[model samples]
Target: MYYNILRGGINLKKENITFLDVLTLFIGCFLMSLSLNMFFNPHSVAPGGITGFAIIVNSMTGIPLWVINLTLNIPLFILAYKILSKKDCVKTILGIIFLTLTLKYTIGLSEIHVTDDVLLASISGSILMGVGLGFIFRINGTTGGTDLLGLILNRFFPSLSVPILMGSADCIVVILSGIVTKEIEIGLYSAISLYIIVKISDIIIEGFNNSKSFTIISDKYKEISSSILEELDRGATILKGEGVYTGNKKNVLLVIVSRRQVVTLKKLVKEIDPNCFIIITSINEALGNGFKSIE
Candidate 1:
């Protein structure tokens, strides 16, 4: 059971999981372990996950992080197995095993600190966590922590997005870890690290090709539209709009452009019609000719 690909935001069918996927999962697990053993664990900073909880437990009970991580994930994997596809289950279990093994082998790395400052440690560790988990999520592979828990809970609560659920779950762990360890700054730093991790992972998954959409209202719609088409080599849509207050007929020009072209577009519009009303808004994603293709 392997996820061939996702379509319309869901895994629709099964296909062979490629070797590249396996290699990517391994690398993701490795980086996560490195962040834990080399950065988070050394500073006693739990950055919010089952791994975070395990770190706190290790600090308190003198237990190996690997044991705690594996123990906590097994039940989660079992719960996730019932709802998820076989492919997801396989990859998730592999993620758990790889992480546990890496945690065991890389425990010695804790003796080496990349930074003595807690703030620096938190930043560096969070960066690795983000990149690692980003790779894992890009492949749609789960490591059976709150990641799995979020998926399972999504069945019960369909309105909330998985990321929100995962973040909420991790937040609870962060708070509890702070309470148990009696360290307020640990929680504060962990919260910061968690934010960076979420941001970086989102960047990796959604990509950096962010775009903007513009709605332009002006008397010189024709000139603005032409300039946009000729100067930007992009398409524009002409829309008929009536101003409610004035009830006057007006032409609205709609344009979409990449982030890099935002300044150029502003200049183009300003030069053409300084009095033109322009509404610019951020676009999370745009598909079709000038952007990402529908999969």
Candidate 2:
């Protein structure tokens, strides 16, 4: 998916965007606005980023959220235009315009809510916003806000992760919301909403088939490899390695499997060679012949 986006970006200078791209952008922004008006804003739960900032401003000054959102994003748009690619800037502008419009028109949507459960509202609202964000990101567009600021800051500080920087910025807003409202639970709920948004956005962008990667070192490498291929119906790759402690050559096995299969694979490996060294880690995405298709 990323490779295709990069390829499309190269040709994006021609400014030829498909109807589907525009449709996706509009849908994403609309959902974001709906979630804000109906769930987050009504409940005073700030989910962080530009949206959170807008929520805070609205709460304090009695201004409409759409107005605050647009007012704050204008400078960010200028910054994006200067720092990001033209294609990116165009998409961001489209997102901002549609998002603000949706927020303006959907002002009364929150009044019709049936549930007052803050937990339910926070989680559901976060999911909606996250999916909206995922769509924008999938199309190589960003909703102009702290996300764009994080990108620009990354240029000056190459070693810092953008998500961390953005997360920290968001926490500050959440904390301020607590201080201003004098309700500690609101801040705690906001933090929960923020976490849900990040997680859901990752799942949308990375795909839903969560998997784990395992690296194994053992004397019975061949048997373990065969068991994984034949018994578990999973592929295994043998990597050549040199053990520095004993100066011995060894074969390391690498395998990928679903989260549920981790226990079964671990048992199989232990049965084959109890002394085997194993390392397991979760992977966000895996695309190829055995897993998801690239397309």
Candidate 3:
């Protein structure tokens, strides 16, 4: 009985600490820390969300950024715990802890003057911060700020999408920039920073080597499948699908290929069977060979 209980407990723990989850948290925290210390702090640019609040509070009170970051994140974390899953809350906590520690230890060492140019700082900081946030989100965790607001919106209004909610939250922050800093330049830089960060984060999390999922209803199934494997060096899975209207049996060829190879694959299918019904969609992250590695 004791041995069984111990084994069960070990398995339970193992289930919690997945390799992908850990990697996501580590990368997310690292990017966020780097962006904060290197770009945002040096220029005193607020990029929005909890970090923005932290920066504003830090500037006004002279408290360390890390302390402000921790205090600001706690209520957001609690909101996340209540609205989101327990696992998400735990992962976010771990990410926040790592971010705080990195900021506390490394902020002093990072270059305080990357560039005197405000535009450069705003752009670079936004990109780095967005990429970091994206990585965290990819693993179904958030850094606790506007993310909590996003979650609350998602929970209460399931129809409203994340992007819409995020936009709404960030817009409020941008408007609040006027109150934080008197100069209009600060607000402009803040807006620029937010834009850069969001776009970059989307790209990073989606990855450069994205894949397209193609569903082709072609008479030349064998030819198309063989060509995909031989020419594209990609794999195809065939599903037995039936036409709803005609009640006719159809051979549906499903294949995933990189963005670079998508045009080629489409052309090949067209050449093989002009009448082929093809549907192509984007797969944000594909793991394994020719894709994102979970590890």
Q: Which digits, one per residue and each the tens of the lDDT, describe model 2 over residues 1-295?
A: 2113332344443666666887889988998998899999888889888988888888889799899989998887776566777677667777888999999999999787846998899988999999988887777777788878787777788899888778778999889778777899989989999889888877888888879999999989999998998878998899999989999999999899988899999999999999999999999888897888895
- For candidate 1, give the lDDT: 0.86
Each candidate's root-mean-square deviation in Å? Answer: 4.5, 4.6, 5.4
Model 2 CA deviation exceeding 4 Å by range: 1-17, 151-165, 267-271
What are the runs in model 3 whose C-alpha is more than 4 Å off? 1-15, 18-27, 79-81, 109-111, 152-166, 215-222, 233-253, 263-267, 270-282, 287-295
TM-score of each: 0.86, 0.84, 0.73
Name the candidate that leads on lDDT.
1
Model 1 lDDT tens row, 200-274: 888877777789999999999889888888989999999999999999999998899999899999999899889
Give the count of colliding residue pairs in each prediction.
0, 0, 1
Please list all clashing residue pairs in model 1, or write none if there are none: none
lDDT-best of 2 and 3: 2
C-alpha lDDT (0 to 100) for residue 108 of candidate 2: 90
Among these predictions, the greatest TM-score belongs to: 1
Please report, in order, the local distance difference test score of every candidate based on alpha carbons: 0.86, 0.85, 0.78
